[model samples]
Target: NATFGMGAISITSEREKDVDFTLGVMTTGVNLLISKPKIMDSIFQFMEPFSLNLWMAIVGASVGVSILYFVLDYPSEERKFSARETWWFSVGTLLMRGTDFAPRPSSQRILTAGFLFFVLITVSSYTANMAAFLTTNNLEKQIQSLEELVERSDFQCGTVKDSATMNFFKTSSKPIYRKVWSKMSEGGLVSGSKEGRERVRAGGYAFIFDYMINSYSELTSCETKMVGTPFRLQEHGIAMKQGASIKSILNINLLKIKESPIMTQLQTKWWENKRKCDFIESQPTVEFGIKHMAGVFIVGAGGLVCAILFFLSKKWFVAVRTKEKSAESDTGLEETLYTTDKTMSKEDIANAVKV
Candidate 1:
């Protein structure tokens, strides 16, 4: 008696008496595997990772923060840091190559810290996600689901010949299954899983197979990925003669192995790891919008408004002080002129009385 290799022996109710199967080693389901699309050619495609609003917000932030920095630490009537130097500092922080223009006051230093934090997070996210966008292909149409597979007429799908997966479609009462079986009966059958996937790679075709094998192919070398949710959930077990004496012992051992870390080790060796590929995949990427980064923009806008208020308040105080100085000088000059007039009148009166 022989147990199946890997996860090939699917446990079925009909074979329970004749074949004494061990507890399932693994579970898998049916799914379709398709090739990754080639990269599409387009203009300004590199900027796709972040939405247009996000890009504009980033630009606005750079300018706003620079202006805020200039207003905060700048001398009222002289130059501590030039506007040109402040701008370079802003750009340098984003480029991750900070300049020598450091802020002097608490407010200016806090502005620098907030901006540096924003730049650190934003730039890291951009560089990390940029690869996915750069390698993107314009896939305007894709059969992402089984219902889509049924509806689309442009391509045909196939499976291994007389396999349990095919039998399932044949026996299923659902119209979609019946229709799929009908299409397969005509010309969609292949001799084995490998040939089925080969037909998939030849283009204008899709292959439905057990998810475990196809999933491994997707990770490693096939440039293939599973589309849609898996169906026909089933377990693969070790098959043996119905009354084999070692069945109970074997079942016990299998359970022990499943309960231990050995199961995880095997899965990691075979499935969890990905082999290096020449091209990186573009999928599973995030498209950053204003919402994802709203906090950064809000903080920057608030800083700009605060800086403007500070500037206006400084101007008002300076104007008030200048008015006070001018008023005191005018008062002193008026008093001196009045005293001179009084002295001249007294001298004239004395001269008249003496005559």
Candidate 2:
């Protein structure tokens, strides 16, 4: 009687010609193994939530709305003000600070109310989006398929030499598989799965292998990940010499084992409970440092400085105008007094002559 051996032996036509394979015990495929992508740190990462064009549009909208409010709130001739006051009123309203001058006309009041409503909506939406963006993590670009792996030149691809995975790539007629095989052959193939996996962990490389093996590797390695869906559907079966008498008996036992709870217990013991790496979903939200809000604070400081300069210039101009007016009034009064005294002297002299 021939002996039967069972393992992850793939059922292939060439192998079948040499040995008889029992019915498939498990089905799996080949997948790409790669290092987990690292999240990149950026100095201006806070601005990533919105695009440059969107940010520009928001600024433009704020200024446009402010200008509109200024035009609508223009005072009448009796209570007239310089154009500067109108602009200040509009900007103050935009900033949610009530302006010194209240809107008097009904039309002006209505327009100001509508603009405030718009501001409320815009600010609320921005706050909500910003919060979400800050709390959530940004994902790095990932390789999702074999075609992407072949097209990208950044990652070197390889597999264990003389392995099933290597054979699959070497014999594949597809252009992507052919390209991958060419690159791997040129770069030199890995000796075994361990070396291939180590290459992936070191980064800048991707290893192709059986999905089952890759899954087990990911459980044990923290920085390793299995990416892309499996391909080349392969079935694992028991292999025995051709015309082996025990093949029928072994197939029957394999079917029974698959249907029983023993299979589930075995898989759980190996894949889950034996995991070596801690599962991490996301890190804590980073607190915003001075650098994060530096732009906002700088802009505010600039506006305050400009306002102070404008106020000082306006005060100086008013003072100069007031002094000139007072001097002119004094000169006119002195000339009038002198002219009156001369007229009185002439009248008195004429009276004396008549006497």
Candidate 3:
């Protein structure tokens, strides 16, 4: 027969020894944990006597509470504590933990509500994180966008062990998106070729299907332009733990955020704010010098030169037209005068012959 009584004693004794060891190092370990955040050291310190003792105490208390609630002669678990008892117990716990000083009735209510809210939020957040991981991992080859990936060269291209894009000069009816991650990890394989952009910029990686779109955008110093059609218009959403009601609240808020024109405007503003010169990149001085003042000067000077030539051409054209009009008028006058003289001479000759 298993000795339940001895089992309890053995467990308590073991826990007591652990507590003593933990407490022995608590002072030093606490200092180091606070200052350095060394995980190994912290673990060692956590094994100290006092720390172990505290842990044991917490476990023992929890176990005792569970036993009392379940095994004791109580109508229900709800009957274990009255409203005031529950409230005061919560307040005392919070105070002892240095979370709250003195808890008023209203404050207790608020804290209770807040605690519930936080629990919901935490559950939802975890769920969302899990969902994201699953979605991203399940993709055969994941890349945020082609435009984003093509901008850099350091980003690794990954694909399945055998794929079409991996085979150079292979013809295919469908467009192939290259994988970046797998290629980098594979031994004795190299991605060939560099483009004009990479030649100009250092640290540019030609990643195939890496989903680090933001990183690519940063490297390219361009608008976060995505390639091809957007697969989906996705909004960042909160996922919740299974059976958590907080997910609904988050979804509602997300919808409101999506519907708000402010959000669109904010995004536009952000993209605009993120704008960088393709030619100059992060070199603000160069870009500013070129675009702001020097460019204007060059354009102005060119316009001035064009204007001068245009004005001179206009003047020359007007002068040529005036000369042509004057010549035509003078020729017409000369012809009229000659015609009159010829007519007068013919009449005189006729008269003379008749006489």
Q: Give the residue spans of candidate 3 off by over 4 A.
A: 1-204, 208-235, 278-355
Cα lDDT tens digits, model 3, 22-51, are: 111001000000011111223443232223
Q: List the residue pairs that clash in candidate 1.
A: none
lDDT by residue for model 2 over 255-324, one digit each (tens)? 8998898878988998988798765533223333344444543454354344445445555776899999
- Which 10-residue window of candidate 2 scores lowest in summed lDDT? 281-290
Query: Model 2 residue 189 lDDT?
Result: 88
Model 3 accuracy (lDDT, Cα): 0.34
Model 1 TM: 0.50
lDDT of 1 by residue, 134-244 (tens): 555333467887677777777788888878888888888998888887777778899998887777777667788898888877777545667888889999987777677
* Regions more than 4 Å wrong, model 2: 1-5, 38-140, 278-355
lDDT of 2 at 182: 88
Superposition TM-score, candidate 3 onto the true structure: 0.23
Steric clashes per prediction:
0, 0, 30
Which consecutive 10 residues in model 1 have the weakest lDDT in total? Answer: 276-285
